[model samples]
Target: MLQEVAGIRIPDTQLAKDAADILREHGDNLLWNHSNRVFLFGAVNVRKTKQHYDLELLYVSALFHDLGLTKKFNSPDLRFEVDGANAARSFLQQYQIPDESIRLVWDAIALHTTPGVAEHKEPEVALLFSGVGLDVMGDGFEQFPADYREEIIKAFPRNNFKRDIIPAFYEGFKHKPETTFGNMKEDIVKHFRPNYKNKNFCDCILHSPWTE
Candidate 1:
């Protein structure tokens, strides 16, 4: 059965189901609920803004956006967002999804953590970022209708998300602190990992081996 929240219908295709199953298998209760909320919030934004988006593609992006935070998907040298995006790309390829759609989904997941720029991308990419922002940081929360927000939260209660999600972020980034040097993920490493040092980008460039 397709679930509808805030008048947006969740896709019920086999690919959608498979994506959900993969998430359920690897994601904890908090991660699963958060993923669903991301989808719902993104859907609501699409409807409220009267934006044209590929709903199924957005659904897949939302579901897989946080996979890199899971133990099953974590990588030692890539940003968690990139790990999650790569996982989504690999999954979609198995089903023969077109290259263009796969790229959109990849960008949507990879750039969900990036602000200002994501909103300028395709509708699905923009909506994914909007949804993630609303769920993770309450950005634009006031723009959503009250009853609709309530319904979405009821369906996927946050369950003390503020306390829980930070550790997940730390765990995902701690292994690849170098990769987060210029991005928001570096903040997590700086705060949680004791004595962690960030490699300065300018210093690296100045000391480059390419000196002629």
Candidate 2:
């Protein structure tokens, strides 16, 4: 049965259930719980705001947004966010979902980690980021009704998220340091991988291979 919090429905379609199963297979308990919370929080926000969005797409986006952080989906070259996005694209393609809907999910997963920009994109994309921010950093968290917030958290306990999530982030991005350039993912490398050095932008400009 689909669960509801604050009048928003949690998707329980077979596709949604299959997606959850995939996450359970590849992700740890912390990630699985966090992903579920992201969906719930996003759904609650959308309902409270009275915005229209494809609930199934939003659920898939939230569930797949962090797949790159799992061993099964981690990429050696792409940013973890992009890795997750590509994985979503490939997965959705199997179901023959419409290209337009697939693109929205792709964008939602790809840009979920980016701040200040995602909230202005498509509604699904915006809500996905909102949920991520709420769950990960407490952004907009206090605005939600306390009882609803408690319901979401109780359904999906955080499980020492603050201490455990960093390692998962590091594991996903450590091998793709270059992909982190110009984004917050770089911060992960800078903090966790001590020897990982960021390429200086000014230095690259001065040493450009092309000189007019």
Best by TM-score: 1
lDDT of 2 by residue, 1-212 (tens): 34775566777888888888889899889888899889888888886678889999999999899998888888778888888899999999989899999999999999998888899999999999999999888999779778989988887888899898877788877777898888887877878767887888988899999784
Off by over 4 Å in 2: none
Candidate 1: residue 28 lDDT (0-100):
86
Q: Give stretches of model 1 more than 4 Å off.
A: 210-212
Q: lDDT tens digits, residues 1-111, model 1?
A: 447877878899999999999999999888888998999898888876787779999999999999998888888888889989999999999999999999999999999
Model 2 TM-score is: 0.93
Going through the candidates in the order shown, the clash numbers are 0, 0
Each prediction's RMSD to truth: 1.6, 1.6
